[model samples]
Target: MSEQRVRGVPAQPSAPDGPTPKRLPAGGQRGGPPWMGAGMPAERSLNFGPTARRLLRRLRPQRLHLGAVIGLAVVSVGLTVIGPKVLGYATDLIFTGVIGQQLPSGTSADDAVAAARAAGNHNFADMLARMDVVPGAGIDFPALGRVLLLALGLYLAASLLMWWQGWLLTGVVQRTVFQLRAEVEEKLNRLPLPYFDRQPRGELLSRVTNDIDNISQSLQQTLSQLLTSLLTVVGVLGMMFWISPLLAVVALVAVPLSVVVTGQIAKRSQRKFIAQWTHTGELNAQIEEAFTGHDLIKVFGRRREVEAAFHAKNEQLFQASFGAQFISGIIMPAMLFIGNLSYVAIAVVGGLRVASGAMSLGDVQAFIQYSRQFTQPLTQVASMANLLQSGVASAERVFAVLDADEQIPDPAAPVRFTDPHGRVEFERVSFRYDPDKPLIEELSLVAEPGHTVAIVGPTGAGKTTLVNLIMRFYELDAGRITLDGVDITELRRDDLRGRIGMVLQDTWLFGGTIRDNIAYGRPDATEEEILAAARATFVDRFVRSLPDGYDTVIDEEGSNVSAGEKQLITIARAFLAEPALLILDEATSSVDTRTEVLLQRAMAALRSERTSFVIAHRLSTIRDADLILMMEHGRIVEQGTHEQLLAAHGPYHRLYQSQFHQAAGGDDPMPVAAASTAG
Candidate 1:
């Protein structure tokens, strides 16, 4: 296949035989095509403590609702804790009834009670006080029924409260995530252009969408479980001690050991989780690039290369994810083992205590249940550690964007333009994209109202940089720019940019009707004004051919239309805006020759009585410009009218001859210069 052309540039040269595969970079692989692996430095090494603190700080706005959720969780857990103990009481009552039934005929109730007391069973003695028992009666069925009913009610109430807690927490999580998403979007707008230039679009997108979603999921699922587990641990420990201090001490032995084991495993898992998510983001970036650049990849026969890169990242993600999960996966079983050990200790010790008549069977049963409950929460907390770690990792990435440096701020007190006349002046301006590498230095120029100035240069000659400085997209390191004799820096950015209209080599038209796209700079444009602007830019010619005319919808980036057609629409938009100043940067470069002719005509009409700055690669387009600045390196090499520059035989003269004279198959340059001057 013939070489495929990329936008605004010539086709890329074919690769050499046996092309070397691209490798992902070190230090988490900082830059590549979005999908190959663009690592965000901030997410590489996470400080769990600080990230957690900041995440909590973000919850300050929702603290009131969070507090309420906590309260409900506590109430629910408390009710749940009480249910088992009440059931244990019912068991003791049944045992007592069986014993009463087994007593010999004519045995007195007081004699049986004395015999139970003689066995050193205080709980049995207390049960007798609460119940009216005949020596031969089997049981107090009514009392046991009531106790069982109360336990059932408590369990039901706990379930209801848990549901309510989940409901409230859902709202809190959603609202918090909503606010976080909003902040990320706002941060994107505030970040400097350089930040976006350095970061992949897909990486930033992952932070906003994927990372934030992880955090939301963690809060929704794990947070409530954490609260319940903590409360359960505390309540169970208290109940254990109430049953028998000896068994409670035995159960306490497992708490510190479980904590130590979980902590060690969690620390290792945290790093793995960070890597896992980082790799996920890298993979996301790769997918975005692959899809967006699908045509490029296919045209270049890079399917194997693309798949190889993807496979490499996919493997890395798999390994990291598996490591994290496998390490965290150890927590549940390990905690459960320790919990079982505690349970056995309690059972053995309690059995002996009951045999010695120091503890009732009912109390031993309750103590064993409490021991199981205590260990159950420990296991839950251990399981949640992985989720908490992953969430913290995601939160770290989200916060990194929020903490990025913003664009240069506006002045403390901004000035406003009044009755602007579009007289622009650049005075001794010096600027650089990086301080070490200067692009434009000590440059000065003045553009009077309603005049056309053409800036021409080879690539990297600061032609576009001049326009960027004029637009205040980047602030100058030194000197200043003025619009209509007022310092532009002092004016509000909106006020300064509002008066200028720009149409670039790359035209931008959002998904909208042709009319809407044309009226983008002037949304309030009337139908007649829109039609007139379209006609002026020759955009109506094609719009009329369309089935829906001006109302036809275009796809995003205006892909539904031809490139030339998109350019004409953008030109029409500038025409409708009717700004005091206009900037056309290689505006005719992408169109075909015929379209270029029509565009040049339309542009001539638009330039009438308007201050215009035209940056062009085709020297023929700006032959009639009133003032031409020929640039090389970072400064203007020559400045003159077209005929005068040709007469002078300077840098502009040499450039014109090399382009036009060679293209015309003429070696002699003087005659062409003479003919141009005569014309």
Candidate 2:
């Protein structure tokens, strides 16, 4: 595909019911205001040489196009100056020689009388008195025509050149934007998960979608405007100096003043812009949260509460945006006021020069026009200062994400896992979500290859944390997790992840067909493989019962499918992956008893040749597990076969008894297990 094409376009034409990957968090999104501007001034001290160079390199492909556009700008700017020069010359001719010429229309006496009055020499009545006042000398029709034609041609050429520049500049900007967007997306995929944990998804979304968009828009506007403004400024100043250096000097006093004023405004507004963007992100986050939890809000009759929360965030966004724009808006009127003052000064000075004959009337007129043209660019430059600053801020934001160094990089030399036999071992691994709060302390476990290892625990027991470690989602604070005696960190993340499959309680289905959903884990799988995988998970029966069978589209997050069907499709996807390690985290929680039995059979088939980690609310699902690790407050309190634990009549036994009796409609508390395994 061309660079203009959006990236991540699928390679195959599949049934459109596939599941998409979860939206990864953006870097700047973590724990901050949503509407923050690009880069902090403090961050500029850090090296961005690489990012600048990279941006320049990306623009290199469009260098030829940019060069052509700039060449056109040069021609256009030349005409912009020359067009007024032509008019000035014509004006000079009219003042010095044209009025006394014979009238082209019917030679009326009144016309001759008016010419005589304009000349103040009665030359029209006494033709021989002044030889320079003859009709051809005064009129010069052919010369006039040539001057008009030349101006017209220059005007047309300049217009055409401007058009071409505008057209080509768009191509350059859009292509660069497309490439940058694709690269940013790819980088997000490669970035370590911990980077996401700290940032908010809404903030990241604003950066990627809003900030990057701002950068792209700013780049286009700045490139075109900066080039044209610079060229026009230079050309007009050159003409002004050519006409009268004194006037040129007077007009330019405002240039430096304008710059100073613009800089002051920029300095003041930068923080505000940052704050505006941060608040916008916060507002977006709140809106997303409220919308996503709309059902909960309605069920709880908290619509008014949600609206109040929304209004609070909206007001914050409004204040920030208004403040930022108000500061930026100060530039235009200030520039125009300065420009008007410069115009008045130039006119007063030039009028004196014209009266004294130090300069011709035409020369004074051209100087006035040129002075205005020169300051026009200055005014534009001042106005666009805001856009440039915004761009830089946006660049800083985008680069902040690109420059984040807090990710867990794989070892320099990654180990190859040719045939992954998933024997996971956590050797004395102690972990904390935060250093001040210990979540799992001195945790160690060994799960043999091709065995179902069940972990039973209440909320916050760190069962999920164990699976996360196995997947290397979060690095251990102090411990090593090895797979078949090799450190998992040494393995390439993609290679390591490819060997594992997971089915979460929150099943995510994208806008695609059931067939596509089933083949999501194996993109290149055949239709037959998709159908077989679905049948294994008992998803095919439901899919086939649908109006269009597997061909039916599951748009809007598979809203058309039942929750149980969504779970079944997720199971089918995992089955298709056929990984060496499978994790089922409350996988069957949404399914009914009949569906649960079918899901168990699917799990049995998937786990036959793979090590499985199961976190189930229903203890019966894991009763036959090879090892049941009973966890409490981040430590494994009991570990053994279900029967052995039951026979031991300790922590696991009492807990199982309470749950087992509860299933039989009894209410009771069980004996507590020791806090830690050693205890």
Candidate 3:
């Protein structure tokens, strides 16, 4: 937007500078195709600690719910831990009852033990002495039944509590993930366009889609299990010491060894998990690129290269995933082996203790059960290390987006343009894509209200870049641009862009009915107004031939429609918007000569009372333009009317001669390069 707007008193509204269309071809411009998933640096991890902490912070909002779940887990584990001990009492009752039935009536327990000793069974006598059995009494069926019933109740209660906690944990975990996904989406909207320019579209989508999903799955599988397993370990350990301290000590011996095994393997698997997710994102980016540019790929005949790239990425993902799973897989069996060793040691020591009258047979039985319970939870935790690592890796990617630099915030009190007169001015404006390479420098110009201004420039001559400055797609490095005598930056971006209508060289039509797509320009537009635009742009003409007419559905890529037809629809969309300022870039390039003539006529009507900035290569179309600008190397080398520029015989004259001279079958010294100006 050069000579774009100025600070001037209200003047009679003439018309916007004419022909606001660009002429650059679709290549080498910073504006790559919408579907091209290229560029952008990947998110790398220095440590999972912060990411893991951040992931847990997502649960902060659900702390109350999580607390309730933890409470239930603790109660459930308490009941579960007490179960084996209660069952051990029941076993003792049965054993003592059977032994008592063999004794004489009314005999003392001491007498039974002495009799066993007299029979030369010293260990058996000692075991019998440790038991609280009456020699004369038969099986105490009532007491045994009560012990069995109590054990069953405790186990049933534990299972019910576990189910309830799992249900609650599911809700909490899902809600946390839902909020995380929403945050990522909100963060994307706040990021500047430059951020998107640097990042691959597919990598971004993976962070939003795949990474979020993996977090949800990982939390759901691990949170409650980890909570319950930890509680079980503590409760079972306490119970083990209560039953037999010697066996408990034996069980404790495996803890450090299990820790060492898990720590060593987990360290190896974490890196693999990170690589696995990174490769997954790269592979996804490639697939999205291949699918979106499928037709282009086929035309270029680089199918083999695309396939090889995909194969390489897919193989990397496979290797990472395999390494992560395989390394973590060893933890479970290693834990189980250690656990079995402890179990055997406990059994042997407890058996000797029971025979020596130091512990009861019932206690020994419970001690063995506690040892198994203790090891089982440790194994579960060790096995879950891979999942935790993978989840944290994904969390780091998502957090990267959330932590990215956002665009400057909109002003609290923004200037409003109730009636923008389309007076755009660039005052000593300077900009550069790279810090070292300057593009436009100290450019000053003004586009008067309601006059057609055509900008003709060579490729990379900062034509589109000028319009981009007006649109604030990139922040200006120096100087300022204004619309309607007000600084563009002073206005809300939405308020500024809402008043301008633009059509690009590359047509974009989302999946929808023809009517809906047209209505997209102005959702509040009336049916009559919509049809009027279609008629003016000549869309209504060909649309009538379709069986569905205005109701005809278009796919995402608009593959069902011809290129010219799609262009017509977009033109109709711009017309329907009824914008105060019009910026058209190669608006008529896709049409046939007949349609181009009609579109030019329709564009003239559209420009009747509006300010327009047109970037044009077809000098014939802009012959009637009020002000013509010839730009080379980002500076306005020449500025005048068509007839005036022809008289001057400068660069614009050479550019003009190269075009019409060839059309008339007359050779000019200078050849007309295909469409001048960068996009």
Candidate 4:
């Protein structure tokens, strides 16, 4: 689908397609292809603690709601304590009733009758025990009913509180993730250019998609179960100690052993989780690379090789994922086993105490319940450790990008150039991408206002690097470049770039109407000015012939446009910018002879009021240039007017003659000497 730009263009109409027109060879256009994802690096982490902490920091803004959710958890667990207590009281009352029915044989009939009557509670005696608790067997049925009703109320309250907690926690999780993703997107725009250079798009996307998903999974697993289990553990422990401290001590014997087991599972899972995310990124990279280069693979008859490469990456991901899950999977069963063992110990030890009259039946029951509560949270914490580690790995990656330095810092004090005279000078400038190898050394030049300077060189002769420096795409290693006698570095980067216009050999047309692409360099330009720029580049005639004219929808990278048409549109864009300095690098190299003539005319027109730098291959294009500079091996070898260079019969003369021979479709050197002597 073609994108529409909201600039100076008519509404575009759709077009049918097989292979739509474009500016260059389909895969080579810049401004980053639409198919490419945001490129950035992934996490390098095997540490869960730091990652979890960072995720928590992301949640700080929503702490108030989270606290309310935890409060609900406590209420839910409070009901758990009351439920079993009610059942125990009811059991004690039933036992008491059975015992009350009989008396000793020596007792008188009147005394026996009185004892039986006393066993049935009077109004005064019933008042001593609270109505909500199960009365002793000496009391009536209404009291037992009240105990059941109270338990029901506690159970209902717990359910209600739990529902509310789930609702709030889910909202918090979603909102927190939304904010995190938004921040990640913002950081993508702010990161330095080199960060993208070092990272793959697929891996970067994995950080945003797969990693963020892991964080959400962690939240879902940890918050709900962990909070409820923790409260249950505390409430059960409190009840246990209340009933019989001795039995409670025996039930906790499994706590230290459970801790050791849980620690081992978590430690193993941490490494596995890290490896898992790494493999996931690798797998994503392979899939992205395969899909993007499918045509190339087919052309080279490498489909089998591509599949094998894909299989290897997929297998690694599967192994890592399986290992992490396996380790994490052990945690729950280990927890259940330890809880069961603790229950058996509590049951055996407490039953003996009860039989010896040292404890009650209710106390033994409560102690076993408490043991489950203790083990449950420990189990939950163990299982969540794996998910938490995955989230941490993702968090580390996100933070790494957020913390990366921005490529261009805005100047504190900025100089702006308006109506520049375009007197550009480079003084003893040197540059290198890596410090160990220099691209250009001690390069110095001066271009006076309104003069065209053409730089000629072999491949890797630092021609493009020199142009990049002029555009300030890369900073120089030493010395400086100035425009109108003002240091370019001191100017705001945006302002510095704004005053200069550049046109490259390969032109990119964005997915938009013809007018929209042309107006990209000046959004507020009037329609008349837009058309005038198109006319200046001689593109207006072709555009007018199209069905929708200026409203024609260009395909991705202007694939629906011809190379010459795309170049014309780019030139139109530069024309709209109306800058004082124009830089054209190999601008007409891809055009046919017919289009080349039109391009030369358009370039000549644009160069009238501007200081222009032309990087040329066809010597005829620059025969009229003010000066020609020849470069080789990062150093300037010659500089003179075209006629003077031809007179010298140096490298320029030989290069000109070689091109003449190629134009004649021959390999002879006669054209070289002939052209040199004729000049």
- For each candidate, C-alpha RMSD in Å? 6.6, 7.1, 6.1, 8.5
lDDT of each: 0.79, 0.73, 0.80, 0.71
lDDT of 4: 0.71
The true-versus-predicted C-alpha distance at residue 255 of model 3, in Å, is 1.1
Tens-digit lDDT track of model 1 for 541-582: 889999999999999857689998988887888888888888
Model 3 residue 125 distance off true place after TM-score fit, in angstroms: 2.6
lDDT for model 3 comes to: 0.80
Q: Candidate 3, residue 259: CA error in Å? A: 1.2
For this target, which candidate reaches the highest lDDT against the unseen true structure? 3
Clashing residue pairs in candidate 1 (N, C-alpha, C atoms within 3 angstroms): 34-285, 35-285, 35-286
- The reply for model 4, stretches above 4 Å from the true place, is 1-45, 76-149, 170-175, 353-367, 504-515, 538-568, 588-591, 617-624, 665-679
Ranking by lDDT: 3, 1, 2, 4
Model 1, C-alpha of 562: deviation from truth (Å): 1.5
Where model 1 places Cα greater than 4 Å from the true spot, the runs are 1-44, 109-135, 666-679
Instruction: Identify the runs in model 3 with alpha carbons over 4 angstroms from their true place.
Output: 1-43, 136-138, 666-679
Residues 435-488 of candidate 2 have per-residue lDDT tens digits of 666778888899999999998866667887788777776678888999988999
